[model samples]
Target: FQFCSTRHELGSIILTTNLDFDKWPDVFGDARMTEALIDRLTHRADIHVMNGESYRFRQTLELRKRVAKEN
Candidate 1:
């Protein structure tokens, strides 16, 4: 958190998580800290809210079916 907040100008950080901002405190273990982190992270970010099953999850099921058929 300190690293990202202090040195954000150094580069970019990409984070992928299923949790939303309201639920971030569970991961950070501090509501205030999580709010601060969200503030800094979203200051100049292009956020994308993705829905539906993840591509990798869907692909894994397909791969398993293909292997079963081969067996």
Candidate 2:
């Protein structure tokens, strides 16, 4: 959390991670480290759980070009 810590003592910081906070232990390795790290993070922060596709699969530039050609 080098990046997050930089923002600490300043104001709120946002974590737009593909991995959930619950999975952070496995992601970071060492649950204790994860706990301590997240503890500092949660002291005054907003946690948003966002899940969705890759976006490219839903809408692509190739498809947009083809649609434009038809028009």
Candidate 3:
């Protein structure tokens, strides 16, 4: 909270989170604070939402297939 507050309009912050805004309270443990943080972060920001399978998970599946074939 302090970090975002200090850098609210002073600098640029790149934040990447898998969870949605509504689920932030689960991680932050404070609904009000999470709301404030989201407000400050999105005030003058360009938001991007990327939806797809995780590269790591896909790679793991490929590795398991190769291992099973070799067995």
Per-model tally of clashing residue pairs: 0, 0, 0
Best lDDT goes to which candidate?
3
Candidate 1 lDDT score relative to the true structure: 0.88
TM-scores, in order shown?
0.82, 0.59, 0.89
Residue by residue across 2-64, what tens digits does model 1's lDDT show? Answer: 987986767788988888889989888999888888988888888999999989999999999
Locate the minimum summed-lDDT window of 10 residues in model 2.
Answer: 45-54
lDDT of 3 by residue, 14-60 (tens): 99989999999999999999999999999989999999999999999
Candidate 2 per-residue C-alpha lDDT over 22-70 given as tens digits, one digit per residue, 9 for 90 to 100: 8999988889878878888988777777567767866787788889999
lDDT of 3 at 4: 93
Rank the candidate models, highest TM-score first. Answer: 3, 1, 2
Query: Where does the lowest 10-residue lDDT sum fall in candidate 3?
Result: 3-12
Candidate 1 residue 15 Cα shift, in angstroms, is: 2.0
Local accuracy by lDDT, each model? 0.88, 0.79, 0.94
Q: List the residue pairs that clash in candidate 3.
A: none
Estimate the TM-score for candidate 2.
0.59
**Residue 7 lDDT, candidate 2, scale 0-100:** 75
